[model samples]
Target: MTLTAVMSAPPVTVAPDVPLSEAARLMAEADVGCLPVVAADGSLLGVVTDRDLTVRWLASGADPSAEVAAVMSAPAVTVRADHTVDHAYRLFRRTGVRRLPVVRGGRPVGMLSVDDLLIDALRRFADLLGPVSGSILHDDTEQGFRSPGPRTVDTNGPESPVVGDVMSRALVAVGADASFQEVTDLLQHWRTGSVPVLSGDGRVVGVVSEADLLRAQDERAAEDPARLTARRLMTAPAVTVHPDTAPSDAARLIVDRGLRRLPVIDTEDRLVGSVHRGDLLAAAGRHATDLADRVRFALLAAVHPDAFSQLSVRADDGLVVLDGRLPRGIGADEVAHLIRSVPGVREVDVTARPSGPAEVHGDS
Candidate 1:
């Protein structure tokens, strides 16, 4: 479907000349995390988000009366109103930005966000699965099947890459007593949205994000900003994941919690590394490619050299397709089963035909 069908239309906008305080007020009143900075002609010039306000203005203790253009992210990545949802997904993966401005003739008309795409995807899944689930339950009842208790499914097989495989091991963390400037400096130097606040024993106690710093600046107006510390400005009980966690689960947690990054912790809740949405997305693509290679290798090992040479394998988003000629002893079902044994393959499709006498033997 096109973006127009799913995008939020008539987006709230702010002028480039608007003061940072005014922009913040508009964001609060509109209940949005970002606002498009538009020119007088309605053309999108840039986008200013809560992160920008916090990290650029509040963290720097810049004048609130300063223009938003000074802090807005410019040359904004955008999507055309007529673009397909698939196109938008690619843009999201490529740009690593959660929101995109929808434009028409260089004029801002709407906004598209990851949340919109996620909701649409969930709705589509419901539409597709609801009837199937009902039929399944009906068949079970008619067959005199009994309920099965909850069971644990192990998703972290050797083939499935865990968070640790993709997480950035180079961590930039701060202690609870770190000065506010130190935290801001670390954020700027690392170019990260948030920093994990560690306890005395090196366990994550909280997270100091741009939002947290912004709140501290806003609420503690009279206090000296230099005296502020991570403990005074952090959000407690940080949402963390372990290294063994599946990348998919980590991605889900990030989306569900509206988090930009997740701190990876050890069994003892000690900070180990970090993972971002972009890392998870890249890992998915890499996993698909790796699965395809494994599938090819499996075919090579199971089938005759000639037949394997003729076979073609393709994998996309965990679905594997195999096409070619199968030897007399091997059936399509057998080939499919072999492919399915590969750990990362979710589904397998085989279109290989039985080889004829001449094809199987080196006969003319």
Candidate 2:
């Protein structure tokens, strides 16, 4: 289960002193999105992905001859080669990064990717089918195990949908001192309802909504508009959601506070992304594979590993079937209700038992 068993070792790498163009050519040759930037001694320096090349270099018009270190994302997020796949899955969900450098003793050893996880998962599922195939075909209760009835997607549940699961990663934020004209132009360009206002240190200080701008224009004369800045028009002490916040609670806050947009902040209250009402609703229809990962991570995050250790999850069409045992004193219905709130989970059918040996429940 450790990364050592699955990671692709002796990964392709690039030197920090290499030109950005050379890095791009290497990536193309290797057919990979990223390359670990390493020092002469083979120590990990940082990582440069296609996104870094596109966003920090090409999009910004940086010279192709610039060093790779100039554009690489530093303090690279990594995992130990001995860590479990579950640990790697947590990193993938929490950091929202597609590739992670697998290291040992502070040196890059291999690469772990989402595609790698998927292949491993498929192999595991294939292995499982060999043992259960007979029981499935000759089941005495086959007639009673008919298809589930039509069920609407459930949104109101105790389980929280983490804001990180649904927040927009492509952020369009403005500085507190940005001119009103600049703010309006950005809003129109991004077509977002509001822009999170950030301080020089990147912490969110306020938010400027379309309503705030309209109110400012309506209440003030045209001559005074030129004097306005984001600091002047934004609503301070902004209402925001943490990346771990449940979408239901966020939605409730939006409705009760009449908010069109909620800024997503990290532990340091730095602006990371924004979530709107539509994002919450649209999340219910995310790709099945993504939803499966989200549900798995959510369960792993909220419930103790011992509780979900034996858990096996399969996405049937849009329904998530959770098969395993619940922690002692936990009810199957509770687990099922929790699974229903995960994005893209149209329905949940739990076939789990209490911690101790007992009669297995068919489904809940």
lDDT of 1 by residue, 26-144 (tens): 77666567799999988888899877886788668788889998999988888888765656665675678988988888888898887666544433223211122111111134333
Task: Write the residue-wise lDDT of candidate 2 on 222-265 in tens digits.
Answer: 45545788988887767777766645555555555555577877
**Model 2 residue pairs with clashes:** none
lDDT (CA) per prediction: 0.71, 0.66
Q: How far is 164's C-alpha from truth in model 1 (Å)?
A: 2.7
Q: With candidate 2 superimposed using the best TM-score fit, by how many Å does residue 113's alpha carbon deviate from the native?
A: 1.7
In candidate 1, which residue pairs get closer than 3 Å at backbone N, Cα or C atoms, i.e. clash?
Answer: none
Q: Tell me the TM-score of each prediction against the true structure.
A: 0.62, 0.42
RMSD of 2: 18.1
lDDT score, candidate 1: 0.71
**Candidate 2 residue spans exceeding 4 A from truth:** 122-309, 312-337, 340-364
Predict model 2's lDDT versus the native. Answer: 0.66
